[model samples]
Each structure stands twice: as C-alpha cells, then as structure tokens.
Target: MDESLLSIMEVREDLMVSPIGDSEPALRSAYFLKPIAKSLDGPVSKVLSSSMTMSLPPVFEPKDWPLVIHFDWRRHTKKKWVEWVDALQLRYKSVWKKVGIFEAIMSIKCSIAKDQNLCFGIAEKWCAETNTLLFPWGEATITLEDVMVLGGYPVVGDPVFAPLQSHEMREAEKKLILAREQLWRRTKAKASLSAWMDAFVNSGSEVEHEAFLATWLSMIGFSSKGLVSTLVFPIAVHLARGNPIALGPAVLASIYKDLTLLKNSIVGMTKQLVLGDKLELEVTLQSPFYLVQIWVWERFKNLQPQPRLINHEDPMMFRWHKVKALKIDNVRLALESAMEHFCWRPYVQYAGKFKVFYPENETLVLIDTDLDKEPTGLLVSFATCLRVSLLVGIQSTIKKYLPHRVAMQFGMDQDVPSCLPRFDGTKDFAWKNYCRPISDRSLYFPARLFEGDITTRYAKWWKRSLMGHQDFAKNMGHQDFAKNIVRRKRSPRSPQVSKANKNGNVDDDSNARKRNSDVDAPSGFLLKRLKTVSSGNSAQDGTIANESIDAYVPTCKNLSNPSSSASTAEYENVKRISPLTKLLAKDTVEPLMGRLEEDFEDANGSKESRLSSERVSLSGTQGESYTF
Candidate 1:
C-alpha cells in the first residue's frame, strides 16, 4: 500500500471507541455469547465417537428466562396506574425527544461535514461517547443528501484576493480598441497619401510640357483659321522622346474631342481652345496642377461670349482690357480677347526652328525658342526670343492684308511707325530715360527685350549717366589737332634759321627776327568733316580723295642742321601718316633716315615709351638740348 494510505489505516486503528458504564457489560456479553443446544445432530454424534477432541471455550447453555430487570407493575398498578398515565405520556414524549435529538445530531454532523470536513469529522468520530457530545440546540436540520447537494468538493484554501477597479479595467479595454482603430486608419491614410504623392511627382515633366502646349494653343487662336498640322506635331515629338505613356490616351482623346467640336462648330473658336478643348482633351495628363490651371483658364473663357474687336487698324490691339473689366453675367471675356488678338502662328513656326511642329489655329502660335524638347522642354537659356521674333514678321504681314472687318474683329490697329529712325530713336531713348515697362506682366520680357545691342547701348548710357557727363565730341578718334598743338609747344623756332645755319650762311639778327616771327604763328587749327548718305532710290556709293603727299615729305635742309622747328616739322609729318604707312615706315625709314627715323620712332612708339624716354633724358642730361 502507499505510505499515505498505510498512515490513514494506522490512524483509523488507533481511534478508541468507549462504551457507556451500565450498557458496557451487556453489550460485551451480547457480543461474546455463543448458543450450544444440539440433540442427536450429526455433528454431536461424530464428536462422541471421536477418540480425542480438542478443548474449546465453554458455550452458554440455554437459560429459562430469569426476569432480573422487571417493572413493579401489580403492586404499583393502582398507584402506578395513575402514575402510569402520566408516566406513559412522559415516556412517549422522552422517546420522541431522544429520537429528535439523535436526528438533530446526525443532521448537524452531516451539515458540518458537508460545509467543513475537518470540524464535522473531528466532532463525530473523535468523541468519547455519542451522548457526551452536544450540538447547538434548535440548529436548523439538514439531511445528509441535502448537505451533499449544497457542497460539492471543497476548494483548496486561497491566500490572495487582489481586487481590480471597474473603471481601470474598462479604461484598459477602451484603450486597446482605440489603438487598434487608430493604427488601422493611419495605415490606410498613409497608403493613400503615398499613392497620391507618387502620381503627383511622377507627372511633373508631362505637366510642364502640357502647360507650354496650352499656352501655345491659346496664342495660336488669334490669327489663322486652319487645323494647322505643324502646331500639333510637337506633341508627337514629345511623346516619341519617352515621356510617360499614361498621358497619351487622354491627350489624344482631348485633341480629338476638341478638333471634332471645332469642326462641327458646337462651340465658338475661343471656347474651343480655352475651355471645351482642354476639359475634353487630355494633353500631358501627368501633372494635375498644370492640368487644373489649364482647365480653370478654359472654363474662365467658356463663360464669355465671343470676343469682338471694333477697331480695324492694329491687329495687335487685343480687346482684353474690356473683357477683364466687364462683369455682367458669369462671362470672362479677357481670354477670348487674348485668343482673338495674340499671334499664336509664330509659335508654331518658332517650334519649327527647333524641328518641332504643332497644329495651327486661327491665330499664330508663338513657340518660345528657348524651350528644349527633351527632358521636358526647358527653354535654352539665351536663344529663345530671336527665334520667336523671326516668325512675328510673317504673322504681321498676314494680318495686314486680311479684310478690314475681319481685322477689326481681331482688334488690329495699323498705326506702325512710319520712320525707322524716329521709331528706333524714340524706343531706345524712351528705354534709356525710363525703365522698360513689363510686357504682358511676364517676368522674362525685360531680359528678352534689352539683350545684345540694346543691352550694350543701355550699359554705355548708364555709365555716362552715372559719370554725370555725355561724350559730346562726334569724332573722338581724331588726335591730329592735339598732336599739332603739342608739336608747336615743343618747337617755338623758325625752320628757315635751322636751314641757313646748316649751310653756314645765317646772320644772327636775321635768324633772331625769323625765330620771333615763327613764334608768333598760330599753334594749331582743327578741321572737321561731316559725311552723310542720302536716302534716295538711286543706289549711289561715294568716295572722296584728298591727296596731299607733298606736305608729308621731309627735306634734308630741315633734317641735317636740326633745331626745335625742324624736329617739330618732322613730328608733324609722322603724326599725319596713316597707321598702315607708319607700320611700313618703321622698316623703310630706319635705313633711309637713321637719326631722324630714330627721333620719329621714339616720339611715335607709345605714351608709356615716350614718358620713359623723357624720364631717362631728364636724368641723363639735366639742361642740354639734343635735337634730331
């Protein structure tokens, strides 16, 4: 057996049961007594015949009933009869009470055992005697079956009963639910935003190109009335260069729809270009922002009536001013005026310069030359306007010959400048005096207008203005008069005295008088010439010749006996020679006129050379005069 079971058995054996004093012997005798009354039975006969029989405990013989414990019924009958009646009642009540007590004890034992096994088992099984133990009086009786039903098996004792707050538990549950909900929402939103941003950024190049195309189309609506194939061709070129294919279908659809409507006259020409065309057509569907801008502008045009120009003179004069101001009805006429007036045809031709073609509208579409088609048509920085202006002449000439009423509808005013000089001078002069006005509110116009020659002139004028003086002398290159004056200052002596002295034939008085006379002559005089080309039908070329070669030839009489006058005369000849002759003279004169050539070369080398020579001469010979 298991050790625990053995221990339980030992405990059960050790339990001592004690009996009541009066009932102890009787109970013992009853338990020990064995009856032995056999008469001629088969077992007694066998025992009598047996030679030897084992001795056994004495069996009790049958006893004639000896009434030792008896009640005095006869003697006390009369007295007891009366008492018997009372006693009988008392005995009946006692028996019933004892039975009830036993039942109560049993009930209490059962109830305690069911609810608490340790207490009930200790009281019932460990007691000295049944009568010695007492249970509470009037305790509610519960049957063994009822107690068993109420208590199943007792649970093992627990030590901790930690209470949790209702509010805290609820809050924990709520937080979990909210966290899950927020995470789900954020995940979904992030995905959506990511998709939108991808589409937006990816569409950038297409959007830019489309915006340019729309601008071109709007400009083209002004002049001619043809589905100009050239204007629409660049779109195909743009697509061929590996632009995203997503924009293709939509752009083609838009073009087809607009062209269809335009062919059918379902919408007016201006409306067709601006609103209906854009919304229905998909040109570079890549950029939502650019597409939206084009759509908005188109819708703005759609709400207006067709633009009409009353003036017939200048086709350049668009009626945009009136359209911008008017507000009756939900009409916007500014776009219509732009479509009617702006020359879009030139843009088409402009695109042609870079090998791009677009469809032609009523007006010329002016392509900006600066725009590059690859990598999204970015304008080449410096070459745009020249190309755009080249096509403007063609558009202008076409507009000039259109019918007056049609021209008036286009708002063309023929008030061009009659004299090119006046126009050039006025425009340049006005630009010089006042800052150039913005052309059509575009930021790029000022840069385009004053480029190249105009820019150079403007810079010169600006420098002059800042310096506070204009260079008024017309022929600033001429230095003959200045050179002559310089020579005169250096030589205040007569050439004749030098010549006579060289031949040893000069008288002092005559030489002095000649020298005085030479000093009195004027130092120099400036001669000015003005040349003008006549503006006449006869194309004549003019040439003027002033051959004065004798004046430049130097004489030996002037050179051999040198004086300040002879040196001055040689210097004057040098200055009068053309730069070509001076260059040639450097080689030829060196051999022919040795010292005189050296003197002339020294004077003519350069300002720096002259200054250096002067400094050397002053340092080397303080007061002496050396003439060549």
Candidate 2:
C-alpha cells in the first residue's frame, strides 16, 4: 500500500487520481514481479526455451482430476431439456435479463468450444499475487469488464446472497432438497446430478424452472464434483423470481481462484523435476476456463485463430465457435514479443453499438412486473472500472474486485492501485455489501474511456520494474530495457569531429536501424502476420484442441438482407407464448429488440432460414443453433 499512490484520508473519494502532498508512488511493482520472476527459472525456463524443438511435459493435461471433467451441461442436454429451455426463455425471459445471464445462457446453448492445450501454458505465466500475466512488456489480466462483455455477467446488481423469503422460493428450496435426498438414497454414497435432473427437469412442476437454473449453476456458473451440490439452491430460487445477482464478480472470482491453483500446480511440478522424483501430476480447474483461452486469443495476436464474424447482437464468444488456429510450438517466445501486438482495449470497437447488452442504471427494481423498460447494458461497463467491491462465489468463496489494479483494461491510465480495508462484518452482513455506488469518478469520462491512452509516469515506472528483474529481462531478450540499452544520443557535431568518428569505422547508422526495428517496429506488421497465419490451411498445423478462435472470419451473410423482417416476426411468434405474457400483459416482452434486429445468417449462407427451436442435438455439429 504505497501512500503516494493513494489519498487514503479522503473517504469515498477517488484514490488513484487524487493528489497527495509529497508522497512517493507505491514500490509494489517490484514486489509483484519478484514471484513471477522466480517462477520463470529452472525447469520452467528450460521447458519454454526448448518447447519448439522437443516434446515437453503436458502442462495442460494432468494425470488425475478431482472434479468432473466436463465443463458444461451439453452432454446432459437432451431433446426434453432443449424444449424446457425454450419454455424458460419464453416464460422467464425477464428473470434471465434481470440476472444478466441471457447471453451466458445463449453461449452455453451454443456449447462453447474448448482447447485443453492452451490453459496450462497461459496459467503458468499467471501471477496470482497481482492477478496479472507478468509479461516483459507490462501487466495484463482479465478484468471484470471481460467477464461482463465476454462472459455476459453483469457488473452491477444485487449480491448473490441477498436474502429472499417468499412462498415460491421456499417451495423451490424444498424441491431441491427432496431431489438431492432421493438421489442420495439411490446411490447410497453421494447425490447424482443426472438422477436429480432426470427427476425434476421439465416435469411440469412449478419449480422445474428453478431446477433448470440450478443445473446451469452446477455445471456452468459454479462447477462442482459429480454430486449435485446444494449451494446453488438459494441462487436459483432468487433468479427464478426475477431478481438480480452480481454474478459477474462471483464468476470472475472462480476464475481467479482456479488460476492460482493452476499456478501452484506448476510450482509443484517444477519441484518434482528438480528433485529427480517421478510423480503422477494432477491439476484441478473447476471454472469456465474456455473464457481464459478466449481472453488470451482476443489480446495476443500471435495466438489467435480464424474466427467467424457474427452480428453484434450475438455474444462475442460466438465469433470463435469451432474456429481453428496455427499450432505455435514456442508459446513463451510468442508472448515475449507480443507487446506491440496486444489489443489493450479490444472491446473499444463495440463501444457505442454494444451498449444494448448492459444496464445503464446502477439501481434496478427487480420485482417490478414491467421489465421491458429496464436500462440497457451500457453504463455497467464504466461502473466496473470505478467500483471497489467484494465478490461472493459458491460455498462461501470470497474475492475482492479491485478494478484500479488493471485500469488500463478499461482504457484508463495505469497507476499503482489503492488498497482498501478488509470487510470485518459478519457473514450475513458481508454478503449484501457488493452493489454500493462507486466512489471514484476522476477517470470516468466516457469519451476518453476507449482511447488506449497511457502516461509517461506509467512507462517510466514499468521500465524500472522490469529492470529490477535483470535476469528475467536479459534471459527473455528484453533489449529495450537492458542495462546497456541507453547509448549516447546523436546530436549535431562539427564536420571535423563527424568525419573523424566515421574514419574510426563506427557503424552508427546500422546500429540505429537495428535498434529502431527491434524497439519501435510498426504494430501493423504483427497484426498482418496474425491474420495471414489465421487464414492458412488447417493441414499445415494440426488442430491443438476442439476449442480456439479464428479472429478474422467473415460474417455468414449480409446484415442488410431483405429477410430481416421475417426473422424478427418469427422470433416474435415464439415470444408470444411465454408464460409471463399474461402475467405481465401491460408490458409484453419485446421482440429481439437489441442486436437481434439484424437477422443472423446460418453457416450455409442462407438469407431466410433459421434453426428449429424445438430441440438441440448434442451431435457436435459445426452450426448447431439452440437460439429458441
């Protein structure tokens, strides 16, 4: 906690931008880098340097996993389950919207593609101490903004543990308990997820909808072992009644926890390598790590695959559906040189157009029957950058959401982040403390939020920090920050001195060219190289995993097609039969009002066709649609 980097005396005020008299900036940058630098030695460094030529240890796949291997419920998604989901979309569309999980459910229905090989490599480089990837260029990590925009979780909402007391909620909880008990009796060991789902899902019971949400939380939101954990009952019941939950923070917490676990596993693996001991390695990651791979693909140009271009109305992850990528044998070398190619603000391009997906207001009235007029997904993006809040995850898991730590992800200037006092309240009181108003507004100007701006102070501090770890810098070839990097600046000299220097055989001109090319190479070159490799034939390099992105594929069809109106009409017909239609007759659920205004084209290039809404097949087809 650097006193110079913050104004701790002023309560409820912006800390980073507020000036304090004569205090030095926080020196924690080196503190953050030390652990990362230490981890990059011995076997880890040896493996990365030679991964391109030799077969290295399979860091991505461990020998044994504690929890269920599947990250999604796609395998359990039968025809009956798809039909129930359709009814759910129609029945409680407002419930889903209030909870900020509409796009998440849509992405889940599309069944996110997975690439098992990408996680361990990326996770090995993660620094849990600072929640960033310690690259030679600077710090970068997945922020709450990534969770909001890419994972479709809302940044502003009621806490996950907000108390609920209603007849319907009570009944839902009871049903969940009964289902778990029934499964326990059948197994005589532990509760079975499959048995519980088969018993309650789409059974025409009043609580079936709640059961569906619980299944999602178990499989997607809060992953667990084979058992149907009772942790999701409260959340599911709250969501079924059209209440808001700050799911974005909770989901981000899970990712961070899993990343720390993976990092620790690598440390353990390296220790075994040094001790001359052969042990079966086991890695356990129980979150939607697909999003982690997606984050890497989105920012690092060299790692990206060719992705399909879909309408903005679609979830951003859909762009990478079933996409392919070039197999990079040397990940560390690519990451070391990825400084210029990284997109600091990838979501900036969709700034004005994608506001429809987020909420505009900080406060939401969840119980109101008229859900049509709720604020769109605009302001939450800005709020996520300014707020200091706590995120509560499954089974009482808690983590802090410190946006200031990675402010650059939100297009703000980088600085030493301020620290807050730990919440000392009781468990019941602490769970409800998440949705308070943001105290900092010094850097909230919307116009400049996506400009990819930086400050000289940041660059100088970053350079000094990298230099502190001289060994890591020199080994990774960070020539720009090397001790010998600075040379005598060329200034106008007398003709006699210039000729005298030239006569001594000094090649200053070539030296200048070499330094300029390495240090100030144009960004477009790497970007173009990324695109070329993305479009190459798949036969050139075998697909690493079933999941990865191709960031440059064209959209399936034109957005201005004449059949757009018919698509909207068809979508409206499905909404007309919603169970909530009569319940909230005053304000009908509007037809795909936001991004769906432009009809999304099927993969076959058809102008006026849509997938059947009846059932979703788990055939693992390239263009399966469960949009209904």
Quantify all predictions' global Cα lDDT against the true fold. 0.19, 0.48
- Tens digit of per-residue lDDT, candidate 1, span 534-565: 12221222211242323222112221112323
**Tens digits of per-residue lDDT for model 2 on 89-183?**
87777778767787777666554456554665676567665556666655678778788778787766666666668886777798888877877
**What are the runs in model 2 whose C-alpha is more than 4 Å off?**
1-83, 188-190, 356-374, 418-433, 440-443, 448-450, 474-628
Candidate 1, residue 587: how far the Cα is off, in Å: 75
What's the lDDT of the predicted structure labeled candidate 2?
A: 0.48
In Å, residue 589's CA in model 1 sits off its true spot by 74
Weakest ten-residue segment in model 1 by summed lDDT = 25-34
- Candidate that would win on lDDT: 2
